[model samples]
Structure formats: C-alpha cells, structure tokens
Target: MTHSTDSNQTLFERAKALIPGGVNSPVRAFRAVGGTPRFIQRAQGAYMWDANGRRYIDYIGSWGPMILGHGHPAVLEAVQKAALEGFSFGAPTEREVELAEEIIRHVPSMEMIRLVSSGTEAGMSAIRLARGATGRAKIIKFNGCYHGHADSLLVKAGSGLATFGHATSAGVPPEVVQHTLVLEYNDVAQLEEAFALHGKDVACVIMEPIAGNMNFVRAGVPFMRRARELCTQHGALLVIDEVMTGFRVALGGAQSLYAQQIPGFRPDLTVLGKVIGGGMPLAAFGGPRAIMEQLAPLGPVYQAGTLSGNPVATACGLATLREIARPGFYEALAARTRALTDGLTGAAQAAGVDFCADSEGGMFGFFLLPRLPQNYPEVLTTDGARFNRLFHGLLDGGVYIAPALYEAGFVSAAHSAQDVADTVALAREVFGKL
Candidate 1:
C-alpha cells in the first residue's frame, strides 16, 4: 500500500481553514495519534470506506448509536417513512409517546420520562429536576466521567473535599461549578465523607455508573451499592447517566445490571441516549412521577427543545428498540463482542505483550497493561506512546478503532465472526511489532 498525502491531506487542509482543529469534534482530528484524519465516505455493517475508497473494519460505531450497525434496514426504513410524513412538529406525536412508553417499560426505574434532543440536554435537565424536587443546590459527580460539557458538571477535583471545584474548561465560571462537587471514581471512602459533610444541602449524586469515557472503568460493586445507600440516607437522588451504555449494555440499561447485582437498588433518575436514537440526535431523562412532574409546565423547573421527540428520530428509535427486544438479540450480540475481545486478548498474549481487556455486552476496552485498571488514575498509567503505535498499526492493517486510548470501543451486531478473526490477526501483528 502506498501512503499518499493527496486526498486526506487536501481535505484536512481545507477543513482546517473552515472548522476549528479541522473537525467538528476535537478528538476526531486524530490529535492523540498525530496523523491526518481519515474522511469517511460511507458506512455499512461493520465497515467504513474512506475518501480514497480504502475500507476498514469500524469499531467506533458512531460512538455507540450504531449497535445494529450503520444503515440497518429496519432503522433506515423507519426513518425514511417518518421523513415522508414530517420531521419536527414541536407538538405531541404518537410515535414519541410509544417510544417513551417502550423505554419506561424496559427501564422499571422510570415511572415517567421527558424527551430531549441530546444527552447533554437530558443530563442537564435531570440535574435541574433533582434540585427542584429536593430544594437543594449542591450536586456530587465523579472525576474522569464525561457527562457532557455542561457548565455545572465541568469542574475538576479541588484541593480538598471542602474546597470548591476548579473549572476544567476555560469559559465555565468558577462560581458556576462551586456547588458542583467532584470526587474520584471508585473511592468509596471519599464518597461517604462528602455525603457526611454536605448531605443536608445536596440535591443529587450523578455519575456514569460504568465510566466509559475513561476507557470503560466501572464503579466497584461495593462503591455503587454504598453510593446508592448514602444518597437515600441523605435524602439525595441517585442520578445514573447511561448516555453511552443505555440500550447498548442491556435492554433496560446500566440500572438493570445494577438492580441484579444489588438487591432493592434503583436510581432516582436515569439519563439515556445513543442506541435509543438509532443514530439520530435524540436522548431522554426519566424518573418516578413525583420527581419528573417537577419539570416544565408541570412545575417551576423548565426544560424544552424544539426537536425533542422529532417524529423521524422517534420512529428510528422505536424500530431499533423493538428489534433489540427480539428473542436472542442480546445473546448473539454479546457473544460476538466477547469473541472479538477474547480473540484480541489471546493474540496479544501470544505476542508476549502485556494487555488487559474487559467487556460488558457490546461495549469493551483494553489496556497495554497486565491487569484491568480500577480507576482513571490507574488507567492513565498505560503506555500511551505504545498505544499510538498499536492504533496506527491496526489502521494500516485495515481496522478502525477509537483514536484515543481513553475512549471505549464498540462491536455492533453487524460485525461477523470473520471480522473478529481478522481484527485479532491484525492485533497480533501489531503487538509483534511493538
């Protein structure tokens, strides 16, 4: 294969002149890997074609919405049919109600739900609802959990628990994040201490139950159980953000998994996105009737979007959900994902490389280390330079993974056993070179 600077270089150069960092999203620029981004022309069933017509196995899955894979026949048909009727009505629609009912039915924790246009909207609204219901101001969140760029949730860890959080981004005012407490993930002791000190004034504790942005580190079972207990004891709501793991992890989302692991455990509010939209721009937040009633025209706390429950988006989501509910959908999907991760792990081991990997359902991540990392700090201990080499090697071998090591990878139902085998073979070759 000849490496040419014609198409990709030309497109990137033109893009940089119009878009900041030559990409709509920062990480997509391949900044972490130090290369020109591959401009994708089309995607279908576990493969994507670049502008140069080069094909590669796609593992990003549009950051998790394409669980059934790009251009799924049913989803595409639903979206197309809905499009003929109309797009956004800004009024009530039967499809929206049906989609909401479907989600509430699967996620028992949600007694009522409100649609939103994006995960950030759902998360931000959930926080507002929590505050309105509790009549409290403070909220606690975990570090390294990317819950969107909401100002209040954008704070990094401060010097101490009692100290106010420092803004992680430039524009976010320090005062805005002062009441937002940032704590380390998997640190049960700190969680308890924070609750003990400020439990009275706290509105909620929001977290990504399974932190995917930090490469799929999960909240320790004990930590998760204890967090729920303390929130209830403190009169604070437990808000589970499942934007990435929602339907992708399980039919009912992360909360369902938690319920099985911890008896009598359920979040007060759950935020959902990704697979629910089926590659469209849609998201939602829901909870018990009493708490959810506090939002919008029902109560003082206000949240609304013009595109909320757009008919096409709802149709796509409904179709995707219905398909996943089919018999053996999850079983087959999980098996395929397991095959890919297991095969890669085995190949790396054979190549005499230190690799640790973990997966749940269709989402997975791996580290260039011997054991799985328990927290963000531990995850940072990975050899990033080595990872960059591996990433480029795999790309050159016609496989596409996440550009950054901190992001988790996805395996859609469209991926075949052959795709998994080929990916493992490529990884083996990459590991040998490393």
Candidate 2:
C-alpha cells in the first residue's frame, strides 16, 4: 500500500492549514521522522487503518491509554451505557465515587483523589497541594522526567549544579521556574547534594518512577531509596508521576513494584493519567487524607474543574480498570512485551546493528546503541539518521511505532503471538537496510 497517497496527504494539507503543525500533538506531525502523518480513519484490536486503507500493527497504543487496545468490548459497552444516562452533570455522580474508590483501592497511598480532565491539571494540582501543605515554595524535578506541560514543570537543568531551572518553552517566563530545581535522572549523589542545599525550602521532589519521555529509563534502586529517605528527612513530599505507568506497568502501578524492593514504600502524593482514563479525558492526583484535604473547601490550596468527572469518562475508565484487574492480565501482557523486545534485540544483533531495549510491563523503549541509556544526555547520542530509516522502513512494512526516538512505545493485551513475530520480522528487514 502507498502510505503517502492523496487520501492521507489531502487531509494533512487541510489540517495544517487549519491546525498548528497539522496536528493537535507535536509528535503526531511526524516532523522528527520527516513524513506526512497518517490520518487514522478507524482502529481495532492491535491495528489501525489510515485514510488510504492501509493497515498497520499499532505499537503506540494511543501513547499509553489503550492498554486493552482500541475498541475494547467492555469499555465500549460501558461508555455507550453511560452516554445514554448523561454526558456531564457538572455535579456529583455515583459513578464518580465508584471510580475514585477503585483507584484508591488499587493504590494504597491515595486515600482520597480528585479527578481532572487531563494529566497536566492533575500534576499542577498536586504540586500546589504539596507547597500549601508543607508551606514551602520550591520543588525539585528530574531533567528527563515529564510530569506534564504545566509552566513551572516545563523546565530544563541550568548550566551548574544547585542552579534553578530555566524555561524550556518559549512562552514560559524564566522567573516562573526560578524555584524549580532540575536534576539528572538516577544520580543519587546529585539528588542528595541538592537536598542538602535546598531541603528546607523544597516542597516536593516529583519524578516518574519509570521515565517514559526520555524513552523508558528507570531510577536506580539506590537512587529511589535515597530520594524517599531524603524526602522524609526534609519533610518534602515524594510525588510519583505514574501517568504513563499507572495501570500499564502493573495492576498496582509502579509504586507497588517499588514497594517490593523498599520496605513500606509509598509516595506522599501520586499523579495518575493515561490508562486510568482508558482512552478518555480523565486524570487524578491524591494522597493520605491530610495532604489532600488541603485542596479547596477543606483548606487553602484551591483547585476546581467544571467537568471534573464526566459520566462517560468515568464509565470508560472504570470498565477499563475492571477488565485489567482480572487475574493474570498483566502477566500475559508482560510476556508479549518481552517477546517483542527480545525478538527485536536478537534481530538487530544478527544484522550487526548496535541496539538495546528495555521494558517493564506493556511499556517499552529501544535505542540504536550498544547499551541502554541511563539518562537524558546519553539518550540523545542515538543515530537520528539511522533511526529515521528504520522508522520509515517499518512504517512501509505495516508497523507503527512512536514517530520520535525519545518517546516510549507500548504493547497491548490485544496483541497476539503472531503480531509479535510479524513486528520482529519487519524490524529485521529494517535493520538489514540500516
């Protein structure tokens, strides 16, 4: 099939004229891979068909929310049933309570949660609550860890250690991020030193337990332990941003995995999105009653959303969570993810291509290097030209991965053994050319 045919090209041309970069999300423009973005007409289990009637095995999984793949039966039914009842009440609903209870039940750290329309809102609210509860104005975030597009968090590390973060985006003022300290991922010593210098003023240390934006890197065990210990010692809240890994990594989330290694491990606050929404616009942040109670009506920190918990969104999220909670769901998904990564690595080796990959559950990332990158700087050393060739090659062979190298890829429960084999075969073909 000719992917760049008029069918998709025409739509993209129209879109670019109307929408910025011809896409709502920056990566969807395919600017990194250098191609016209596919205009998806429809999607099914593990597959998406573009406007040109070309089908590809979908590995992006809508970034992370489609863990059960597009059009899950249970989720679809629940959403439809909810739409019949109402769309948004702009008030409370029994379904909202049920959804909150479900999330709180799975993650013990969240004694209470407030739902929002997107991950950015959830993250921003969490930070505000942290500062208000602790009466501190500063926060520490890792370089590659993405909490959301919130202005204060949209920052990069400055030239020297202990320096305040600088705004990465154009519109964000430098003063906004003056109190935000950006550090390197998995650097225990650097983290400790930062805490030593500014611990008293810091309200929270926010991080993605498994960093997904820099393509699936994890904090070392020692680093994780030290951060938790220092946060407790400094009276700073440890906020785990699990928007991507929440239910996609495991049933209990990435926090549960950490609890296994660290005794009594739990974040003072947690940020959640993606899979919890099950492909809808829903996200949340919560913690023990004390900190959460700081948000409006109960205390000084104020946050509110007009459509906080839409009936349809709650129904979709609730149904998706219930399905994934079934016994052995994650085990099967993890096996499929492992098969994909291991197969691709083996094929790359046979083709004499320098490559490495890593995975947790359904989320995974690969790099064109001899060893996996441990931090943002190392992740940038990838061969961009070679990766572009591989990306287009796989795309032409009917496989869809993320358009950018720094973005993580996802596998879904809808994927089968045959799907894994086909993806590996396609990668081997692409590696041969590289």
Candidate 3:
C-alpha cells in the first residue's frame, strides 16, 4: 500500500538521461500535469502496479487496446501458442487470412483488408490509397480528430475556410500540409462550403466518428450524414478512422451505430487499430474490392512492411474477436461504462463542481465544464490547472486515468462493480477538495 517516490523519481531520472522526455510517448512524461510519471512494472486485470509497488485501477486500458483487460486468458493462450510456431515469416500466413476474414465478417463495408503495424501506418497508407484511387491531391480532416501523426493529418486549421491547413509539427514542411483542409468537428456548414469550393480536388474526407483525442465529442449525426453525401456527390471517399473506436465501441463499431440512425450509412474505407491488436502492435485499413485493390501487388499504390500482419499479433486479434463476439459482451460492457459515468456525475454534483460526461460502449470522456464540448477550441476552454489537481488527486486515490484531460478513458470487461464504486468514492473525495 505504501508508494516510494524515490523509486519512480530515480527511474525517471535514469530514463531522461537516455530516452527522449524519459518516455517513448510524450504524454507518458506527465509534463502536462507536472508530476513524476509512474513507471508501470506490470498490469493485470483492471489494475496496474507501478515501480514503487503501488496498485491503481487502470482506466487508460493501454489507450483503448485492453478491452478485455490485461492478459485475458484466451488471448494469452493464443499469443503463446503462436509464438511457439514463429514470430514473423515476411511472406504470408494462414492466420493473416483468418484475421482478415474475421475483421471483414464484422465490418461488411470492407470487402478487403490489409494489416499493418501501427495506427499511424494504417492511416497514412489509407490516405495514400484514397489519393491514388481518386487521382486527387487534397484531403479534408477535422481539427481534433487525430488520424495519427501523419504529416498531412498533423495540421491545424488555416486562416480561413477557403485556405488549407498549416503544418503543426516542426519537421513537416508547409507544402506537405497545404493540400490538407482542417475543418471544425461537427460543423456541417463549413464542410458544405469546403466541398463546394474544392469538391473536384479533394481525395477523401477522413474523420473519427467520435473525436477521442479532444475528449469524446460525437460527430453530430446530421454532420455525419451530410459528410457521406458530400463524399458520394464529389466522388471522394468517406474514410472513418476507427483506430480507437473499432471494437471498443461495439461489435460492428461506431459505423454500426451511425448506420442505425442514417439509412445505408457506411464509409468508403475504414482505418482501424487498438482493440483489434489485443495489446499487440497491429492495425488495418480496408474498403470495397475495387478501391482496396488499389494497394500493393494488385495496384500502383505500393505499401509494404516487414512486420505487417505479424503471426503472433494476428493470433491475439483473432482470439480477442472470438471472445468479444459472445452474446451479452457489449451489453454488459456498456452498462458498466454507464455506471461509472453516472457515478462520477453524481459525485461532482454533490461537491458543487461543474461537470459533464459522455460515453459509447466502453469508451468515455469527461470535462470540468457544465456541458460537453463539441470542437477542439471549445475543448481547450477547460481549466487545465483545475483538471491537473483532479488528476493528481485521482492518482493519490489509487485510481488511474489519462494524464491529460483531452484523451478519452476506456473501461474493460475486467472492471468489477466494486472498482467503479471505489473510483467514484475516490472522485467524491477529490471533488470535495476541488
């Protein structure tokens, strides 16, 4: 129960001397919250143990891949069996075909699929395929819907709607981002204007159905329906980046939810990662036969990776898919997620704190504002200092959440009712202090 700061601080200092920012990922550095990052030694079920040997209920879920929680028995068994067979062959494997078939079965829109190593690679390749298929140069992306750190995608909104975005990263040249048009999330009017101006030149309109990076902002149903229409009318692909929402949202994904609301609703292409990998390094992109066939040996849009469709990763994914496919899996997960959100909302109300939250399936996000935000600029209006205090208080209470407020949190099947209750109790304590 006792946590020693020396162990974490010493490890962090040693890591900073060697690795950039003392972490492989920038967010793990805890720079936003101003604290020594916890050096996670191991994770099991819904709990993670830091290097200081303190346990905390984990809500990050390895950023949305651990839907069944860490080391689910079925997934572990499949991974172990596959590792015994081989790691990478660089040619092809039956497991890859099976994984592809499994994915295609769930996602009907994708007649074909290609596995990759990371979400960034999958997204980047999807954009290239979009460009090659349409023979166009421009792509439309929203400001807060992160489609990985791909150069064209890593862009901020330009001076005006008519102007394209500017590069947000240092190494990415301005020319690389000039073709990318960044729009506001859930803005149908701006979307219509952009399409009217450059419909002929746009290759694809890519977006996350629910923007996760800027917290959880659902792309308005009206906005999504209009986006599909605009893409169809302009001969541009409607690409949905489901890297974070794919299986985490539902059996069919966020697309399935949209389809229920909008008749015949579906994207031309879908880019996916996270839960599909089952905590391994794997991602995929696919669409209809004619379009997806545009990539690799079949077509001119060449893409290759030595580690693509890795044997062990595919096994892990296949196992995960099988487990989640069982009856009542998603229903149970959704109910548990609702419980957590409602509990937190109640706790905040009791403490007289302004709070709002939203969730879909097992994915959730909360804000200190009185109501949920709809776009990147609105999301930024949250008081960072106040959220940081809440972050530290949760950490102190042994309930782990994302270090930054902009990121969405995940709940796993491994999360017990007790864990949710304890988390709310902790939050209530913290809210009182706030």
**How do these models rank on TM-score, best leading?**
3, 2, 1
Candidate that would win on lDDT: 3
Best first by lDDT, ranked: 3, 2, 1
Those runs of model 1 whose alpha carbons end farther than 4 Å from true positions after fitting are: 1-5, 157-167
Backbone clash total for model 1 is 0
Taking the tens digit of each residue's C-alpha lDDT, what string does model 3 give over 1-434?
56545688999999999998898976566887888999999999999999889899999999999999999999999999999999999989999999999999999999999999999899999999999999999999998778887788777621111011232666888899999999898999999999999999999999999888887899989999999999999999999999999999999999999999999999999999999999999999999999998997999999999999999999999999999999999999999999999999999999999999999999999999999999988888888789999999999989999888778899999999999999999999999999
lDDT of each: 0.88, 0.90, 0.91
- Expressed as tens digits, the lDDT of each residue in 163-281 for candidate 2 is 11233767888899999999999999899999989999999999998888878788888888999999999999999999999999998899999999999999999999999999999
Error of 3 at 127 (Å): 0.4
User: Tens-digit lDDT track for model 1 on 1-434?
Assistant: 34465577889999999999898976586877778899998999999988777899999998999999999999999999999999877899999999999999899999999988898899999999999999999999987787776889766521111011233767888899889998899999999999989999999999887888778888888999999999999999999999999999888887888889999889999999989999999999999999988887989999989999999999999999998988888889989998988998999899899998888889998999999988767877888889999999999999999888888899999999999999998899999999
TM-score (C-alpha) between model 3 and the true structure: 0.97
Model 2's TM-score against the true structure:
0.97
lDDT for residue 124 in candidate 3, whole number 0-100: 96
RMSD of model 1 against the true structure: 3.3
